[model samples]
Target chain A: MNIAILGFGTIGSGVYEIVNQIQAEELKDCKVTKILDLPQNKDKLDIIVCDINDITEDESIDLVVETMGGIHPAYEFIQNCLQHKKHVVTANKAVVAAHMSDFLKSAKENGVQFRFEASTGGGIPWLASIQKAKRIDEISSFYGIFNGTTNYILDSMNTLNEEFETALKKAQQLGYAEANPSADIDGYDVQNKVTISAALAFDSKIDMKDFPCFSMANITYEDIQYLKSHHQMIKYIGQAIKKENMYEAFVMPMVFASNSLEANIPSNFNIVTLNGNTIGELKFYGQGAGKLPTANAIVEDILDIKNQISYGKVSLDKKLSYCNTLLKEKYLIRTNCPIENEWIDSVECKGANYYITTKAISTKDFMKLVNSISDQKAMIAKYM
Target chain B: MNIAILGFGTIGSGVYEIVNQIQAEELKDCKVTKILDLPQNKDKLDIIVCDINDITEDESIDLVVETMGGIHPAYEFIQNCLQHKKHVVTANKAVVAAHMSDFLKSAKENGVQFRFEASTGGGIPWLASIQKAKRIDEISSFYGIFNGTTNYILDSMNTLNEEFETALKKAQQLGYAEANPSADIDGYDVQNKVTISAALAFDSKIDMKDFPCFSMANITYEDIQYLKSHHQMIKYIGQAIKKENMYEAFVMPMVFASNSLEANIPSNFNIVTLNGNTIGELKFYGQGAGKLPTANAIVEDILDIKNQISYGKVSLDKKLSYCNTLLKEKYLIRTNCPIENEWIDSVECKGANYYITTKAISTKDFMKLVNSISDQKAMIAKYM
Candidate 1:
């Protein structure tokens, strides 16, 4: 089987190396025949193609792996490949999150498989596990540290008592975060992952924009110290819970007990969890994002296709509505203007900051209250 | 597809419940047609069969789920079913650990699948995950808390300051341990699981008895307290590492940092890890053994067969020998007898007990020295 990789970048080059180096019977006949990238980025002379049609038009190429890491041309190219009856495997979460339903529909109509195991949790076999689990169990909820960059920053702040910006800069130096790191630190990366996970786990179509995401960019050193003093530490998490026919999905910085699993997740590692009816709660922990790890997941999907191992079909037929008001939890609010509220359980004043602990309140209500305030520097975290 | 259950126990009943309750497209036509058990244990009159031939001879029964926990008849019955070209799914660790290679051989000859996902980490999708990982990466080593009963005992001893016997009794009351409790406390259960895991991970046949297993039964409350004071906690773990042409595998009580993931694994929960070439380290945490959880795994295998999803073939053709002297670590020894050796780093006498810490020494050397002593009450643990 001939394979083509879109974008000869970090993950794409790693995929090419693994496809050529792995000694597996199923992957023995598999070869990277074409690479879609700019002329200057070409490492191999024989297989470089700047146009998508050059590879899509070739009937010999049976599979396409997308590592382009964008939504625009990657999504259109994936749709074209599926329409051509070619199997598609991707590590792009943004495209999968935005066009999952459309891609599934196209793949179904074309009788091909569209897999994105690397789209969430990096090297962790999370999507395949969830698909297997859904065969015999009902997945009611899932939540975890989906972004490695924010996790690194938060973990560093807690352990080394470093400021948020200092930790983020360190993460940037280590290549864990990009120079323009708003997608990761501001919770957009986690939002995309949460959308993909919820779609697969709950069998429902979810819009990434519909889910409210609270940024971890505003978390300060004082907040981490205060939470640590209270036997808790902060972790940026993307969580989705199913309540009857409604679903509540969001991304926020949450406080966990110092000794809990979430707090103990050090460095840039991630821990994702799923609550099943029969299997109970199962957690998958590993490197959330990296070149080789992410490439390993993409190769796994390729092998699955080669061995005729189908994860069945991607069907989001479950009619579940989104409602953040269905879930309620206590919140830790740090702001300059918080004087009176019935939900306020306790309040502490430190210099110019009013740190208030609110009683159990709906996420929708809390976000509404926070948005009503003109203080853009206010930071809110959930109590886990 | 008609299915036959070879036991009417905890896991067998769970498989039946999930197979009937799961609303999946692939399992729509799958039904439990026969159940082999004694007449006194019959819960359903229409499907119960006392003889093995009642299941093997039935041409309509295409699959057999062996939940009968033993080596004798369970092993023989599984072989018979495979000889009859029936796919077999089992949760019996003892049978799988002892006759895994033989069962794989028989299943291959008859063109059938022999799966034991629940034999290692119950409901955690451990074996399946390992198989998927092996398709693309070289697994070098794996280790974790494979036994929940022993973990519960050790955790309770550390957290509640309960004696070993008291914790064992608590485990029994919660149905986590059997009446004998010998298999769990003596590390035989973990040994069996490690054997099965190593066979699948390294593609080599291993004997459960060949690997050394240290009993956690001798651990005392004072040992837990001493370790706690040093910022460590005891956890019973089964580990296997590949070193070129040889492999080192063992079951022993090891100390981990207090804030580590292993130390915080409370209650009867289990955590297993695998180290892959590309995926780095991935940890799976969940209930290792339970009625519904184990059964859920069995049903997952059954569904795989129904959907024509294969884990391919199992071939333990890797010519790897077992050796224990290649790995080295420090040891904490507490005994009534005086110990003197070049490896000893420090020693302190507390009444009639001698608490000694040894420098890095191979497990083979430490065990040989411990066995040379006539004192049967001596306790030793490895420092991680």
Candidate 2:
């Protein structure tokens, strides 16, 4: 099985190394024949190719592994590979979340497989697990700490008593967070992940825009202290639920009890859970993202394609209506100007901020309330 | 695909219900055609059969699901089914731990597949996850609370300040523990589970006798309180490590910090972990033993077989020596017997008991020391 790795960056190179390191009998014939990367950045690799056509046009390349972490060309290259009758496996959440339906259609039309196990929970086998469970059970809901960078920041702030900025700086220093970490801190990373996961779990195509997201960017030390005083800890959570005929998907910084599994998840680790009708709740925990970990997941997908391990077809055939207003929960709001609302159950004026606890309110209403507030520094967290 | 179920018990009935509930396209042809059980136990189900040959000789049955939960007839029935060219799926850990290698050989010789995803961590997809990871990475170690009954007892004792007997009674009342309770409390249940998991994780056949087990039956409230004072909690842990040329597997009550994931696992939930060379640590948590959950796992295997989704072959071909002496850890011991050893780090005498904390000691040495003590009430726990 000849393989081509797109983007010889951290994850792509890691996949090449793991493909070489595989000692399993069934995967012995697997080999990386081509690597698509910038010519100057190719380093010492002889297999490096600067053109996507070098991979897609090669009839001998049985599979293409996309590790390029973006939407545009990765999606186009994947589609091209599928059109050329080559199976495609990827770790790019952005590409998967944006164009999964189109990729699935292309793969089906070309009679190939398109797998992205590393897209949602990196290295956790979460997406594959959901696919496995879906074979016999209906997945009603799934939610988790989806982003490693945001989890690291929140965990450090809670455990080490570091300020939000201090933890964010540390995360950036460790490479867990990038220089411009808006995609992670502002919930877009988790938004992309939850969108992909929800599509698989509920068997329905979920528009990323339909999944409302609340940023953990503005969370402060005072907010953490208040939550801790109430015996709660905050974690950036991405959740999706299958209601009667509707699906609710969102990402937010939610409160969990101190002893809950979500609260105890330390550092950059992620814990994603799926609620299966018959199997009950199953939680998968591991390194959500890393070079070797993410690469390991991609390798698993590659082997599955090589060995003809049918994950069946990628189907988002369910037609559940996307609705965000059906789910309701109390939220903690910290702001300088909260004005007034019927949902405000209690308000505590502390220093320059008014810490208000709202009654059970739908996510849509809460988003509207937050937007209506004039205070730009206002922060909100779901009390789960 | 016509299916035969051995033993019309909790798991068997659950499997029957789930098989009928499956809405997937590929599994729509599956039907439970026969059930092997005692004559008097067959109630309202016309598919129930009294004799094993009724299933074995019937060529219409394409698969057999064994949920008999024991070592004797269940093993024999599975062997017969495989020999008759029918795929076998089971939820019996005892039989799998005792005869997995033989079953694998039988299935291979008969050109059938034998899968037991529910054998180890009931409904957790633990073995399946290990197999998935093993495809690309070498699994180095695996450990966790494999027995849900013991976890419930320990968790209740810690959180609710319940006595050992009280917790055990509650577990029994809730059907988590058997009337005998020895399999769960004496560590045999975990011993069997670890043996099965270690075999898959390391690709080596391990004897149940090689995996030493320390009973949690003798643990008292005092032991829990003492550990609590040190900010530690007790959990019955089963661990297996792949050494240079040997494997070390054991089951014992171990101490973890209160904030650890192992400590926060409440009620009857089980959390099992596997450390792969590339993927690092992956933890699977869920209902370790329940009718619906375990049955759901069995149905997954059924679907895999129905869809012709090959999990590759189960090969216990690796030849590794089993040694229990290499791993070392501190131990907390409570006993009335006089103990004098170089490994004793500290001794605090409470009312009628000497609470001894040992230095880093091999499991072999610790077991020998505990055996030498005549006090039948002696309790030991590993500090990790």
Candidate 3:
């Protein structure tokens, strides 16, 4: 089958190499017919085509792989490919987070498959593995450390006892984080991933704009030290727990006991755990983001399509509203300005700043209180 | 579909409970038609049948569930069911380890599927996950902490600073260990699991008798403390690493740095890691053994069959010769009588016993050296 790759960048080139190098039956006889890239970037590669129409207009191209990560053209290109009766696989989390339902509907209508295994949790096969179990087991909830860049920075900070700035610079130097690292450090990357995961896991569309994401930018060495002193390790987590009949999805810093798996997740490795009612907590751990790892996940989707495995039933039938106020939880809050509040049941003054661990309170209410407190050094983390 | 269950014990009854409790579409119309058991064991369960012919002769029985744990009758029973053109799903590791190739051959000849997800890693869905990746990636090797009973005992011994016998007694009290704990304590259980995993992961039959298995019974508090002093933690590991053209499969104690993931695996949790060529290290972790967890895995297999997801092509095409002489590795050995050996590069006399850590040596040669020094009191562990 002839396949075209959009954006011959890191992940795109990796996919091309794997399809050419791997002798497995799933990838055998498969050829990359065209690689859509910028005209100025095109060089010795004969398959590189600047025009997107070269791929969408080609009738021989049975599949299109999109590695160009953005919502605009990637979404349009993927939608066009699905409409043109060509199967589509993508590693773009933004497009998937925003337009998954539309893509699924278009693919189903056009008698094609739409797979985005690489979109979330990079190489971890998070969505596809969960989908397999979803065929029989009802997933209650899932939580994950989805962003590799942020995780890398956090791990560096803890391991080297360096502050957040040093760690971020190191991650940037290592190509783990972009120069403008707001997407990762500000928690938007993790938000997009968890939103996509929530959509598939709960069979609902969680709008990216609607989901509240808490950033790790404010996470300080003092906070980490305080957590360490309390025998807890801080991790930026994306959790989607079903309470009553609604789903509560959020991205925030949560502290787990020192011995817990979440606390011990080292370096940039990603761990997404689905709590299935029958299957228990099944975890998928691996390199969450990398060129070849993400490319490998994309290939898995291609093989799934090749083997005539129908994209398991997914729908935006229920628009799940993000609700974090369902259950009460213990929280660790550090603020320099907080002098009085009913939520602050207990407070320990570690120097000038107060380290307060509140009683079990709804996350929404507590976060609201946290948001209201405006100080240079105010930070909040949950004790889950 | 009418299903017959052989051996209505812990896992069998748990399977029955799940099939009855879960209202999944795949198990909707499925009914337990007959349950085979010993004459004296037959009681209030109305579906119990004394004669094996009751299940084998029933043409309406479309599937058979085997939870009978043994090599003799369970293996024969599964082969007979396959010959009768009935799909079989088993939780019996002994049977699967011994006759996996034969069962697969029989299933292929009779146009039936043989699945034993419960046999290897209890509830982790390990083999199924690996098979999914094997479709697209070439896996090189895998290692796992497979047996929960032994893990529980080891964890207890380490955490509570208890002796081996005390930990064993506690494991027994918790129903994790059997009265005849030889299978688990002797490392035979891990051997059986790794053998089955090797057959699937490598597409070759790994005979239990051919593989070398080192038991946990020889491990003492002193051994644990000695390893701890060196910033290492001891774990019983079943490893199958491929080198050149052969596979080296063994069950033994291995030491990892204190901060490594293997060292942090707490309680009875199981971790199985597979190294794929492109995907890097993928890990599956969950409750590896329990009545309900094992039963849940069986139900997963049943659903796979119902969905017609062919048990991904597995072949005992080549009988893998176990050879541990492929690569050289570091080892820590404690012996009552060991003074002269060229391989021993470092020695520390902890007490009356000599703690000798050897330089890199092939596993086969190292084990041979260990065997020679044994007054049945020598303990050896690999440093990985």
Candidate 4:
């Protein structure tokens, strides 16, 4: 089986290492037939470097992996790979959450596998669990601390009683945070993650263009101290709860004490819980992301695909249809603002720290409300 | 895709409930075609009932489930079904752990799936994790609280200070135990589970027939108090650790103290920790057994098969294979009887608590030691 490495950076190099380390089975027939680098991206020199464009359309490359972050040629490269009937494996959440519907549709049409287990919790196999959970019965609710960078920062702040910025610096030093950590710090990373998890859990596609992705960006040190006084520790939590027939996906700063199961999820580790009608609750805890763990998922996909091909069966499931509908939730919010459910109608800001429930509002509706709040130059709002 | 269920008992009823409740595109075409029951078993009106013999040979049943407890015709029937190229899914651990090598080989030879997910940890999906772990790399160690009944008994004993007998009786009253407590208390159940886990983790078969499990069957209240003095709360722990080319597997009463993570595992909940070289220490926690959770695994297998079928693929995997080879392990013996290992030239025992970490010993040798001690009417012998 021939596989291609696309966007040979940190993830690409990790995948190469993973393939190199396959010792159990004889891989005499297996090879990384091609390497797709940024051409000038000299950080990756070990592999057989080729233009990223060549392998996307190469007939010999059976699998193509996208590791280069952001929404550039990565999208085009992955789409083209799928078009060429190559199975596409990616760790890029930005591409998956945004173009999942389109990509899944195209991949299914073209008979190619589209997998992104690393997109959500990098190291842990949370995506497969969702698929596995749904097999028994419908997944009613799903929630977790999906993002590790923010978790590390929050953990550091709580542990050392350090300011947020100092904790953020410590996180960056530990490599859990990017230098420009807006996505992780402000909840965009978690938003993208919950979008993917919501899709997998509900069998629906949830794009970033929906919902007010509640973040800890605006959380003050005073709030943390206040939470401590209430026997709580603040955490950036990502949740996707199925209420009624739809769903609500968000990341919020909640206060759970250090001893609470959720709060105990320490630095750079992820603990995810899933529930089906039949299977109560199952929680998976592990190193959510790292060079080794992320590569592990990619390798698993490789083995899964390889085994499928060996068994003379390969089918791409790209329908992108599932519990994609938005979630309406009763908000237990706290804020300093003169507001009502009507002004922030989608998510009503009620009494100081409370908010009215979004009476059957969708994610798109809430996104608009949040954008409107942002437009007013107010500290917008965060939902519970 | 059509399937039939046998034994309309606790797990069988769960299989029925989930088959009726599931509503997904991947499962729409899949159906439970028939239900098989014992000759004297009652429920006749609500579903199609067929004799187990006919169901086993019938060409119509693509998959057969065995919820029937004990060996007897259960093994013979399942074996016949696999020979007929019919996939078999069972919640029966007694059958699998005893003849996993035989059944797995037959299934592989005949191109059928013989799944027993419910056999271990109810619905925590340990087997799939094991399969993935095996494919990824060599599993270094596994620590599991696999038996929920014993766990409940231990937890009850800790919290209530009830005697072992009282706690066992209370567990029985709470539906945590079957009428026959020996299956759980005598350690055969955990021995069977750890045997399977050992095989899965070590890439080799472990003979339980050799070791003949010994547990805390005669533990006294004073022993519990003694454990507390040692700063440890006792629980039946199933562990398998690999050393170089060999592995050690056992079910024993270990001193899990308050400071340890395993101590946090409360009640009938199960937590299995795997220290993979790459993934560090990963822990999977959930309800080990219940009507819904056990049913959850059967439902998961059904969905897994259904998804494959819905995509025009075979449900039974041909890639994964069971290890049926012999291996060696160093056993640490702890017993009341002073069976000094120095009496045997090859075996060296230290004090009454024999630290028989002699050169790697075969399973047969380990069992000989157990039986020799048991022959002297030794109360308990724990192997580390």
Candidate 5:
């Protein structure tokens, strides 16, 4: 089978190495015919082509791999490839989360496969497993540490007792976090991942714009200390709880017991848990992002396509309403301003910040409380 | 598709309920044509039949589910079904581990699929994930807590400070253990599971009788306390490390740090970790065995077969040699007959028993040492 790789970046290079260098049996017959990248990368490889038409116009290219992350040209290129009756495998979470429905429809109409196993949990094979489970069991809920960059930073702060800036720098030095780390620390990365996962786990079209996500930047050293004193650790989690016909999806920092699996997940590793009606709760853990890990997932999709494995049409019957108001949960609020409410429990002082553990309140009420107390540099972390 | 049930026990009944009452889309067309059981169960259900010929003679029965869990008539029945070009799904790990190669050959010759997702790791979707990963990357090694009953017993002994007998009784009371607990406590259960997993993960046929396993019954309360003082916890693990073309498979008590994922798995929960060439370390955790969880996995296999998902013929290229002499590991040995050894770091007395932590040595030498001191009732647990 002839293939083309779009974007000669880290993941693309890794995929090329696996397909060409590793030469595993599953990919032995696959040959990379073209690699589309910037003209400057042409001198570095013999197969590099600057024009996207070189790939899409070539009818011999049976498949295309898109490691080029972004919503613009990558989506356009993949759409063109699918329209030309070529299967596409991608590691681009942004594109998958944004235009999954359109891509699925195009693939079906063109008689091609559109698979993005690397979009959610990297090499963990999470999304594919959830898809398999969904065939027989109803997944009621799933939540996990989706982003590895923020997890590394949080773990560094917890273990090394370093401030957020120092931990973030350490993560950057280790190449776990990017220079422009807002996508991870600000929760946009996790939002995209959870949206993509929800689409497959719930068999619905989940739009990222409709989901609400809270960043990990709100967690302070004082808040960590407060949680430590209470024998808890803060973990950024993307939770999706299914109810009736609608689902509640959000990304936030939740407190897990010190001895819990979520608390002890070391460094940049990811752990995801899916709750099925008959299967109970199933958890998967692995490196969420890296060159080889993400490449391995993309290769898995390529092999599945080569073996004629394809997923059935998703239901899209259930609506994914990003509402968290119906469920009541206890909250730990840390702020400088004095908060007065009957639901608030006793307050404690750690350094200059005051911490209060509130009684169970609807998530809608908690978000409203946070918005109202924004003047005090307040942060709310829910209990897991 | 018409289906036949080989056994109407716990797992069999659960599968019936899922196919009948739940009525998921994947199983909507499946009709339970006949249920084979004793004549005593005939009054409870009109489909119950004591004769095996009733199922094998029925040409309309396209699929057969075997939850009988033993090697006797269950194996013969499944063999007959495959011979008749009927697909078979089983939850019997013992049968899968013992006669996997035979079943695979039979299925291939008859143009039928033999699926056993429920055979290992219960509803965690472990075997299926490993199969998916094997397509893209070579698995180097894997180890995990495979048995829920023994884990529950060990957890009870650690947290509640209960004796072995008390924990055994508690496990039996909760229905996690059988009245004849010898199979589970003797480590044969885990040995069977790991053998099956090794066959799939490495694409090699592994025999359970050739693999060495140490039971939890050998671990005493005093041994647990000694390990606890060293900031470690004992977990019954089925570990398989790959080297060259040979793999060393064993089920034994391995000590892990208290904060490790394997150690933090509480009660009847199960966790397995696999190290792949490109994916690094991947972990899976969930309920290893339960009526619903096991049933759910069986249903998953049924759906996959219905959708024509077939596994490639596994390559048994590598030889599975039972040799542990070359692999070095630290062992915690408890004995009264130990006088001197260069590998022993130090000896400490806990109550009337003497404990020693040995430096790294080949597993072969450690087992030899244990065998020489058999008169002293010695126990050895390796460090993870």
Candidate 6:
């Protein structure tokens, strides 16, 4: 298992450190072969500084790990590796979650393995647990505080009485949040997580747009204070609900009692749950994001594939189903403006913020209503 | 996958509910063959209800789920099931942690899986995660708040400043603790958790007597107030550390900052961590114990055996080494008694309490020193 790391950043260095510390001495078939990076890079002993074309002819490169995240060249690098029949391991949840169908098919076609347990919950092995549990029952729901950055910011604001900017800076300093924290704070990070999770749990072909996302950025400090006054804690939650014949995915700030598991998850930690017919509620909580922790997930998957226990997942494209019954679900809308519309069922307002629970409506209709009110800056979240 | 529920208690009833829900599904070769309870039990379901003796002859029963708990019949019953070549799934961490060698040998001899993912961190598939991650790297350490009853009590004490008795009663009322919570509050419950985790993480052949266990039973509200004075929260933690040819297991009351993952774990939820060479550190948090969640684990194991996936772990008897080089760990000790011991490298007594930091010592030496102080109880909580 000679491996190649594609990036040299935090996670890449983390992967290198982890790989160098392999204690499976008896199972020494696994080893890092090439430290792949930009051409003319100097850091280590006899490392290959080659592009994807050069990698194709290198049969010595048995395992390729891509820590170079993004949807472009990372995707291209992985696709080329799969074509060249190199087993691949990655921490790029975005690439796998969005294009698992294509990758899985391509991997199978090329008789190679693709693994990305680090994609979802870093270091927790939540993916491995879910994958192994799949033999027992289909997962009915999957939910979590998937983004550690947002969780840290929110917890700081509530506990330390720090402003959002101050907390954001702290999270960045702590390396929990990126310089541009939109992906995390705006819920798209969680959206990617829930999308990937839904695809894995339900084995369905779910696009990112299939699920709605609502971030804490849309939420005000007033909402947090009010929720706290009511003995509730706010958590940016990524939810995937499976109904009779269909499923729903979204991310929103949930107001739960102080005793709720979601409420107590503080700082840059994560708590996730899965409900199955047989397993009831299964949860995984941990360091949601970090360099070594994230790298650990990729390493675990690499070892797992080494043992031939299992390879990532059977692509979502193979399990795609257009569940028509999910269209008739109800929506939960929270708004800052006064509800002059008939869609509002009940409103609980404190100061300028309000939680307006709405009546049953199709997802399509709810999206239409939200789009119509988008220009007004309505707090029209989504049908969570 | 024909399974049986041995005890018709809360967990057993939950298992039945899940099985009933999935009775008409396309799950491969799975169904409940029998519901085993006491000798005289009657239900409307069309499943076999027989004595323990009748269980061995029933060839249809492929998996035996032992939610009966305790050491007796549950252990003997599981042993019998393994002898009869039926896979055994249990939520009993106590039995396995104490007698893991015997159980693993028995399962191996009979060529049957003895799955216990529902053991320590209930509802969280920690055992399965450990099993899968085993292929990756050698785990250096593993530990967490594995007992929900004590966690619930400690969490209540942290939030509401409730008395221990009131919190214990509340935990019992909320179905988090047993009527007699001596095992939980007294640290024996968490002791078993650490034992199992150590066995899984380091393949350490150490039981309750191998390390030291200090309880939360004596974690007075006064102590809580002192911790609060330092802006800390108290939690009952079961943790393990591995050193060269040695390991330590203990359950004690710990003080942590407000926003820490371990500090923020609310109510009865449990969170554990795996510190391995390749994976670095992975943390799992979840509902540590519950009727439905435990049942889900049992059912999930059954499905694994049915699907021919390797869910059971290798025996820890042969590969029993807990050796790690990082032995000089840091701890925060709080005691009402004065710190006059030679092991106390540093001490600071403010009010009726003192915090002491100790030098590197073997776990046995550490406990002997802490226990040397006779008059008042003390807790030496691990930080790393």
**Higher-ranked by TM-score: 1 or 3:** 1
Q: Candidate 6's residue-wise lDDT over A1-384, tens digit each?
A: 778888777888887777776555424666666776766565455765656665666888788899988888888889999999998888887888778878888899999998888888787767766765565566777877888888898888888887778889999898788889888888877877787788787777888786667667755565567667867777788887777556766677766666566777777878788777655566676666688778877877676667566623454643454343364544445566555566667778765656776677666666666765533434444333
Cα lDDT tens digits, model 3, A1-384, are 888999988999999998877888667878888999998978849889998888889999999999999888888889999999999999999888888889999999999989999999998878877787776677889998898888888888787898999999999999999999999978888888988888888878787676567778888988888888988888999988775558777788888887677777888899889998767888878999998899999988887777766425776686566676776888787888755777777888887788888888987778678777788567777787
True-vs-predicted CA distance for residue A88, candidate 2, Å? 1.5
* Ranking of candidates on DockQ, top first: 5, 2, 1, 3, 4, 6
* Model 3 chain B worst lDDT window (10 residues): B310-319
* DockQ of the candidate models in sequence: 0.74, 0.76, 0.66, 0.34, 0.80, 0.33
Candidate 3 ranges beyond 4 A from true positions = B41-43, B336-338
Per-residue lDDT tens digits for candidate 2, residues A1-384, read: 999999988999899998876676756899999999998976678899999988888999999999998987887899999999999999999999999999999998998999999998999989888888888778899999999999999889988899999999999999999999999999989999999998988888889897678889889988888888888888999999998779888799888998899999999999999998899999999999999999988988888887778656678888878876888889888899855998899999878899999999998888788888888778888887
Candidate 4 residue runs with Cα over 4 Å from true position: A26-28, A38-50, A157-166, A217-233, A257-260, A309-384, B38-43, B46-51, B154-167, B209-235, B254-261, B303-384
Q: Compute the lDDT of residue A116 as modeled in candidate 4.
A: 86
lDDT scores for all predictions? 0.89, 0.89, 0.84, 0.69, 0.86, 0.73
lDDT score of model 3?
0.84
In candidate 4, the residue pairs with backbone N, CA or C atoms under 3 Å apart (3 or more residues apart, or in different chains) clash, namely: A123-A288, A202-A323, A203-A322, A204-A322, A204-A323, A247-A327, A248-A327, A333-A353, A334-A353, A341-A348
lDDT of candidate 2 vs native?
0.89
TM-score of candidate 5 to 2 decimals: 0.97
Per-candidate TM-scores read: 0.97, 0.97, 0.96, 0.78, 0.97, 0.80
Residue A328 lDDT in candidate 5? 85
TM-score of chain A of each: 0.97, 0.97, 0.97, 0.81, 0.97, 0.89
Question: Residues B41-127, candidate 4, lDDT per residue (tens digit)?
Answer: 545635556666667666877988888878877898889889989988888888878888788889879987777778887888887
Q: In model 6, which residue pairs have backbone atoms overlapping below 3 Å?
A: A3-A33, A279-B296, A285-B285, B1-B29, B243-B323, B243-B324, B244-B323, B244-B324, B245-B323
Between which residue pairs do clashes occur in model 2? none
